[model samples]
Target chain A: MDSNGFRPEHRFDVELVAVTKRYGGTVAVDGVSLRIPRATYCCLLGPSGCGKTSTLRMIAGHEVISEGDVLIHDVNVTDLPPVQRGTAMMFQSYALFPHLNCLDNVAFSLKARGVPKPERHRRARDYLARVHLQDYAERLPGQLSGGQQQRVALARALITEPRILLLDEPLSALDPFLRGQVREELKRLQRELGITFIHVTHSQDEAMALADLMVIMEAGRIRQAGPPREIFERPADAFVARFIGGHNILRDGAGTIAVRADRCRLGIPEAGPHIRGRVAAVEYQGSSVRVALAVDGGPPLSVVMPDDRFFAGPVQPGEEAALTWSTRDAHALPDPA
Target chain B: MIGGGARSRDPREKRPWTFYALATLMGVFLLFLYGPMFVIYLLSFQGPNGGVTFPMVGVSTVWFEDILKPGQMANIPVAFGRSILLAAIVSTITVLVSVAAGLGFRRRFRGSGILFYLAVASLVMPSLLVGFGIGLGFQLFGWKADLFSSALAAQLTWTLPFGLFAMFAVFNRFNRAYEEAATDLGANAWQRLRWVTLPILLPGILGVAMGAFTLSYDEYARTTLVAGNRNTLPLEIYALISSSTSPTLFAIGTLTTTVSFLVIGATLAFVFRLQRRRALARHG
Candidate 1:
């Protein structure tokens, strides 16, 4: 907690200006700048260790700036501690205080911020009820199931009504089935509350579903930042195109062209504008079956299609197939390599 | 299922020598144990030399009664009270400080790794060494090395590391999402620490508290070195033994041993009950 720091009055949205955090000589985040709109659900989408969480932490005042300023509500709170900044963070692992029961956990911030006991309970109960965890108020975090505990955590954060809510992989811990449900619930809550939510996740699907504004990052750099449609349509670079969706990554011309599995048309070469390949393997996954193909000497490519449609008839185990995709769908990637 | 019919490696080949050796050594050690303590307990009750003599020359409770004279009897309550008070203060402080440190270190920071290593190094230092250092340091500050204050500080030094490590393990296993969720819900640092961190760390804190209390209660080396002339039970027992008093230190030993075990057992039971409740809640 730095004492000699700037404290700007609240009015502006969250902004990151030329932020740099280096782990030793290796720069985890190098000169990243971003501005999130007020009450927007923004996501820092990236691969593992891409400084998404670091950037989020810096904004939340958990991590100190190496060379930049973090402005919240338009005020420069670069050196203010998290508490004094009136910001809240949802940790990647949910770092809930395990000692408190669900209700007490929800009421923790209220109590610390000097809300009286009766009012604290009222506010906590309201948030808990919002997450549909009112009954588990007396239960400790360990006592609740993973999903239930997450709800308690959500309630805890929402009760504070901070200027901006920071979430670090908040839904990564749930079972896949529950992850979907929670993700939907989270999306719903964000819309209803309309508070600024800055979420950090490695999952592209999660970002795609939840982000109103998505910033795709890799190796501490923002490859692309835009609305979901714009990012998906015109991914600013090759990395953004490759990371945001499953890309049939391939060398095209002097640069590179990435075609999504769904976009890659699996038809005959006679149809034109298609790549000829031999079927390597087929994986059935309920709704979709991923068909792996070896394209000449190039890397193996995966083409995903609806299971019901792709397996309508017997496609030979080692047979050859023609793959085609529109040039519009083929994102131009940079030759960074 | 298809690979299940393959011939498995023989079970005997999987056995390790260390387990067998440990089991055999433990069996032999237990066999040789209880002989000396059993003899002392028997002798403490024996009439005159090993004879089962009556009141004058036989088995009697007179020695037990003699062991508790009015003066000694009064000292018992006072000494017990003091031990309890010291243990309570030391253990409580140990738990609180260690929990705070443990929670702090649980989160990653610039110098967190260095701090963790230093804490581990401190924990590894011998209790006598720490006691000597504290005692010397306190005296340098012109502070009298008393039972209450000096012993409290020394015991904290000896016990806090264990408490911290125990709590570190708790935080490591705890769900980070709960903390995150609390944070998302608007918990500030202290609020999150109080509501989420402390609740999850409760078992480890209590477990360490009980262990620290018992350790401080029976502690000898550091307590002896730093307590100056303070007369704790262990120190008192040591005095009677070296004074050629023939006092029943064995009886005191047995009582202290039982007290330690009881405290440990009670803590374990409490933790177990919490675990069971947690299990039941999950299932329900």
Candidate 2:
């Protein structure tokens, strides 16, 4: 949504129309349909081998679309090669060319497109400067740190000025601190460029932190696709609810319901529809304490309470406790078909 | 405890007895490998009337000078040139063919197993037998086995397998992500291969090329049966051995060794320069 009152025209940047990818007999991506809005950060979040990468590859034209079409900027690009699809992919390894220097790696696409050497170098230098890597243009990939190499990859991918950028597990190789920093940097770059950035990641925190449009996939199909807050607050199925962690899927008498750990309070059994369970484990996280419990010899349930609140009423690992959440706080998940 | 602190963590501690034993073994092995070559180098400095079997009469360049004059039966310069040309051709063909085959073998295809085994079989088979087989094939086709034709083929049979195996090892360490990244960055097949694949694998390719050149340059057995009219340096050296008992043979050996050293040294220098340039790029 823009500042103007009227809805903006040409909102959709990339559209995947019933896209299916099959590797021989096995289907990697089964008829996934999605519309990524322009200039927004979209994350395809899923576990490994769940078609998240395959979906990203198909959008980037690296994978062939078996059943349907992919459209970028309203142009059908399903059969087109990656170079002609107006999309650039940043590989998981960062894939910086070992033989090429930073400037040369960034300038490679322009050189391939037959840009003159001086002009390509000038443009490449501009992009390197944009990534604040101007001083390291002559350095080989091996000489730079992992984060620096990632920036080089980003700069190289951005040099083509594609309408959409596809990244596969963009920050999986980074350490925790660097991952956070780079994730912020990626968001900032996407905001500045005002182009669609479709990032694929397995971490729910990464997706929630970076995405305006969050897509949760399972087993080659999209379980849910919406804003991050919406998906977190209301996952469409059991798979999404479980995958997006910190949620306890409890089976009451009626049906299964997903309730966030923080929302479930430790209380006496008579207060509400309480689950009586023994404390299995207690993890003292800095901001919150996660109390793991087993209810009626069923699946384990956990409740996250603020550290100060939890210590005020600390329960030992062997003690019995009753857990209850308000009915309104519980989000019902669709039954598995 | 049986060895009592042999694996001590302290760096300043004395090394275990196994170290001395291994070092002594390595020393003896090196001596066994290079002792004969050192004697040949020393005997090459023999006097004009010196015999091939050592105890030098005097140091002279007379035998070395004899190599320049074309003999009644053998010409050292011509054979040396032929050896160089043949090795160059073999090296070039070996590198090109092996790199292509190596890239092809990266994917699993039908008959790849058969092709791989055939290469290994060619490598382990007797060199004379391979030469005889190629020579026989040429004869069966009513063709004369020459230095550039049948001899080149026989040498290739030896070097290609080495080059291919080298390439296999090289490609094994190669990451396909680089090529995928190239494709993602808008490089076509030829561009990806030329810019990404070859450059990254340059060091290994150079190693293979050097190995092929050296192998072909010094090869004798395979070329012996197939070489019909012309003689390579090794064959000429063999003929010189049968005909005369002079120190000229030692001189020829010394000269060929010198040339080999020069070629290998130049290649090492080239590869070093390439590495150094890339390294220095970081500081720059």
Candidate 3:
């Protein structure tokens, strides 16, 4: 029914049709087209200023689209406000109302819609319980810990029961340990609610761990969009290969190619391509040992080896080693446009 | 091996020469600030037949009693009431207009810079000149410069800029994310302003209102030319100073200073209570 073949029954929760965002003369999101399936977890992964947050804000209707249309549930929501478009956003800092308690923060939307106090409070309490924050209903956001504040934010965003939830760097403020816990909770909540979530983050690990559909953006354009494993196995270009860490981008006579750091061995292959370089640094990372190779006239590369395999041979810094991987393991990357 | 005989100097025990110099400067500044008011307070209690000098002729409350009686020099009670009414009007208008302008200024628009410079430019102009200009305009228009009209306008020229700058400080620290979050949560513009923005900015708004009221209450130069026939308390006090010097003038000064202190004290207490109510709850 649309250019992206979106239909009501197809149940695509969000679709961006060549959406572009501009500030003055400069473009932030340059004609990006994406379709997020219903109930899927999608991540817009890119470096800072790569337009991921701008794109997310455009989708959430916080930022106006400069060109093209945004559709939600087969409805053209380009001109609609965030509330009318059935989208709610959780800001990077959580943006909880500091003056209000957790219960009031979560009930704010319903109150805005003219819901009665008792009914909204009852609903807000249920939402708080959903986020395991029932006891924190009376506590202000400042009284809560960072993780608790994030959960309260989550409850506030979810109380609207939006068709799509937009999160902008939701875990960047939390400690590393709490990030993992919140990540798990977010995944579980998304599954339980059966709604689409489009998250923006610069961390590739967060994207790979959470996204069912991962979109890698460079500058103002989306470079690749697919499953995490698919992009990991066959990166679309050198930028994608480099942006998605744990992959070594190598140049040869044929073209640029990407091979997983784990797949590359520390010795010359019996009958395949190999490069010789000196070990620049060796880092012990508990489960794995990372060996940085400094090749002459080339970018540095790393090999992540299992700790047991690394200690068995014991390669030290400044030692010469030949890196090789089977041809089958090497995936050729496309040139940049 | 470290020797026990050598001792490390305690940082707190040492004071640089600059510290003593600055301390003396601060002490002198405070004395200069409060010394005149202290003398006025002492002289306000002079006896019935005492002069305005510092000899303190048997301290009593006679000069204070003179404040309530209408004298040939000036009507103290009427001018005092007029001063309060004018200040209330000016304070209310300053808060309304400055807050609206402050919110509008959060976004840069065409000619916004020029508008801001023009508004702030009034602060550097002589206060008497500002009133003179307004009085001239009223004369040209064949209008009477009364207490509420030209006087109120001239006083606002002094207070509005202060109110606007105070709001700039308030909004500089205000997080815009709250507005965005309100929008995302389905709050319309009016609802967002009423329920979120105003409540969050209440403390800052209260401060601006208090500052404007104080500025307007004590204003003399800006209101002098435009005050027409009737006078504010400050103008009446100035008239009494020229016509006849009495301990009653010191009583008026003491009473006004006390009123100012009470106003400032009440506002601070209210703001403190608001802050404490919204402060982070202590955890066990």
Candidate 4:
């Protein structure tokens, strides 16, 4: 067994023990601990200033941990440089070297390690081909489209062969249509490489689509950590329920609970918990139509209905509506700490 | 046809009165700027019997030849060599120090604000007074002031701030993600700087070098007290001006102005070539 008393089968690819980052009087990332398994796609999901990026940077060895330790492959890497930490970060902007062509950009890590020219170039070309960019070897980053640049960045990071790849909002810069395509490519890449991938993003949809383990963070702490389905079904608190969209948070005699928008029905049920409010909005989202309601004593709510179901009995914006959900669909959320 | 004619005429049919006024003002400004330089160029080619005036006595290159003879009052070639050497030194030092300072200032540290203000404060200080202070300090230390020593230090005070400010503008637009990406790709600190940072900042550094070179080449007031025994080109020209007036002075002026133009032209051509190469790759 290792010094941390973990069995061989239970060893995590990356582990953080109460890692904290403080700048002067303010704490940026306050005591975050996490464990990501081998080959798992883990996403740190949070809003701006929620320390998700800081946690990712700490794991990559880019930011120093003020309080605790960061361990990679069961080895403490808190004092090591990024190169020694076995982590590669793909930046949000892709950050490809503007002056270097695609081939040189991908070969940068090999060059840094003092590898000779022809060998590095050959290996770099192979990696580029993996990213489907072999034809654009000589093109500079500026010559490539936004999505192509991100692939080049991926190839550049992959050349290092790090055990864990840290992605900081890699798909945020792409257009919506391109974001989905790139997202699929990233997941396929992670699976094929069989390495742990830790991605940080503010988009709940992105996290839900890619993450095997979705970590919801708020104000430098993890609000909930589980599979996407688990977190979606049972958010730890009101904050997480709101941040992970399409959840209707309601408060009644039984305290706070979160119900999926798709599970919420418009007409009042014969029996079961229900909320009455004025219909605030009706939005058509191609396959699904969303109906937002303004409640008197609680936050606004929304109900997502199938387009066919919504059209059967259309509800106008100014009409009064009663939203009801089955008791099993309603999950209790703890009060915010 | 009527709609098309009206649409075409709408944009260009009328001229604003301010346009004519501004155009006339620009014309006069250009004439005022180049008027004396044109006269100096004409007078520099005056014949042996010619004077430094608009009425050319005869068309000859005698004054240009006279500039090479090393007259009793001045040694143009030696002073010119000294000026070039000093300016080169000053330019190199300014670029190196200011680029380093610019990178260091990216991160907030203790006394960073105070240090930045102190470095930039030299820009607004009177040049002569700064030279006088350096000269006085040399006297106190019993050190001899010369072109390479005290004068080099003095010129840096003038050029380094400009270099620092230029570098600030360069670094402002520079994305820190590039450096972080380099680091993540396993490059050490020095490797990241040499391969990534320096190549990206090269254009701004070149501009800083060119600026420092010209400023040092033409600097006279600051270098006056610090240049103890031997004189630089500008000081030599000043001495010649006080001693007498001749077409030879115009020759010297034209020669120096030509050198300045060549330096600026070469720098611009190099920067343009670098940009074009990048642009070509972007559109290729």
Per-residue lDDT tens digits for candidate 4, residues A1-337, read 7553534564899999998999778888888899888899999999999999999998988787899999888888899899887899999888888889999999999999999999999999999999999999998887788889889999999999988999999998888999999999999989999999999999999999999999999889988899999888778888888899889987656878888999999995577789889999999999999999998977889999999999999999989999999888888887656
Kindly give the number of clashing pairs for every candidate.
35, 0, 0, 0
The DockQ assigned to candidate 4 is 0.47
Model 2 agreement with the true structure over A1-337: per-residue lDDT tens digits: 3442223466588988999999999999999999987888999999999999999988887777889989887778888888877789899988888778999999999988889999999999999999999999998886888788889999999999988999999898888999999999999989999999999999999999999999999899998999989988998888888899889998766798899989998878775667989999999999999999988868899999999999898999989898998888888877767
Give each prediction's root-mean-square deviation over alpha carbons.
6.6, 5.0, 5.2, 5.0
Off by over 4 Å in 1: A1-12, A84-86, A251-255, A285-289, A305-314, A326-329, B1-21, B31-35, B38-60, B70-232, B235-239, B242-249, B262-284
- Considering DockQ, where higher is better, how would the candidates rank from best to worst? 4, 3, 2, 1
Candidate 1 vs 2: which has more TM-score: 2
Q: How good is the docking of model 1, as DockQ?
A: 0.28
Question: For residues B85-120, could you state the per-residue lDDT of candidate 4 as single tens digits?
Answer: 999999999999999999999889999999989998
Q: How many residue pairs clash in model 2?
A: 0
| Segments of candidate 3 deviating more than 4 angstroms | A1-8, A268-271, B1-17, B46-51, B55-58, B69-74, B280-284
- Candidate 1: Cα lDDT at B256: 59
lDDT of 1 by residue, B1-284 (tens): 12335887787877689989999999888867966665555556645333422223455455556556675433554566678788888898888788778767866899988877876777678878888888899889998899988878777777877787888777776766565555545557676776656755567778889878887888878888777665777777776667544434555555556677787898899987766554423312
For model 2, the docking class works out as acceptable
- Put down candidate 3 lDDT per residue, B62-116, tens digits, no spaces: 8888777666634887888899888889999999999999999999999999999
Stronger candidate by lDDT (1 vs 4): 4
Off by over 4 Å in 2: A1-11, A294-296, B1-27, B46-66, B69-74, B276-284
Q: Please give the RMSD of candidate 2 to the true structure.
A: 5.0
Candidate 2's DockQ: 0.39
